[model samples]
Target: MATSVLSKSVLPKVPKTARKTSTKTAALQAQPDAHEPDANKTLNLILSRLDDMKAEETVTIDLRGKSAYSDYMIITSGRANRHVGAIAENVTKGLKESGVKSVHVEGLPNCDWVLIDSGDVIVHVFRPEVREFYNLERLWTQNPAVAAV
Candidate 1:
């Protein structure tokens, strides 16, 4: 009978050839998980990773009182589809490693845009053109664009 989860997690491989048993044991036990990280820690981690990935035109819109979905929304651009996917991948990886639970990802296949939802923070990695078209920052912001008379 199959478990409720569709897929099973693959354990990290232990090198049978390794001379030291202690090293192998350490490697297996290194994967320690903690409770969900605080909001500031989570936000800082995401920002740092984006910077490391050289994401362009990054914008952080504070949605604290505005939205219940997440406390912060980070919007950034990648040079191309591949870069976008890479940025999304890095963000998700960092979140998981830091013990953020149940991170949800979408639009990875197309890579034109990827949304990573980590409960506390929402990050959007997009290609330059797609970002301009969607303009999520404008939609979320309280101030409306003033029309010329």
Candidate 2:
């Protein structure tokens, strides 16, 4: 009986230059470019969308130092469930159109309190009563030094 052995020559090798190029491309892609909007821009876009959708009692809390989850936390009130749903939808669309690759949304079915997590910003669109009950503004703005818009 004869045993067959495989040789290194049978395997295809990737070129060193190709590997280097791929590494460099991945690194470049990982870094945010000038075209990408910063946290402030994203916050502004969200605020504008909320305003366009007629969200009420809009409050923006700067959560940069306080929370690692998001740079800004926006709490706004909608007249009712439908309004809350609309506000969240508009924000999601606006953020996506502005080049946000992923925008996570929750609580859309009931719309009691819709949460839109757009990387740099977190938006909560709630019914007026729900917003009052949660009182996220008071909870988040314990420190008056943090700017609120």
Q: Each model's C-alpha lDDT?
A: 0.88, 0.85
lDDT of predicted model 1: 0.88
* Count of clashing residue pairs in every prediction: 0, 0
Q: For residues 50-75, what per-residue lDDT tens digits would candidate 2 score against the true structure?
A: 88988998898888778767898899
Instruction: Compare the candidates by TM-score and give the number of the best one.
Output: 2
Candidate 1 per-residue C-alpha lDDT over 1-149 given as tens digits, one digit per residue, 9 for 90 to 100 = 35534334444556776646687688867865557797889999999999999999999988776666788989999999999999999999999999998899999999999999999899999999999999887777645332111
* TM, every model: 0.72, 0.79
Any runs in candidate 1 off by more than 4 Å, and if so which? 1-34, 142-149
The true-versus-predicted C-alpha distance at residue 138 of model 1, in Å, is 1.1
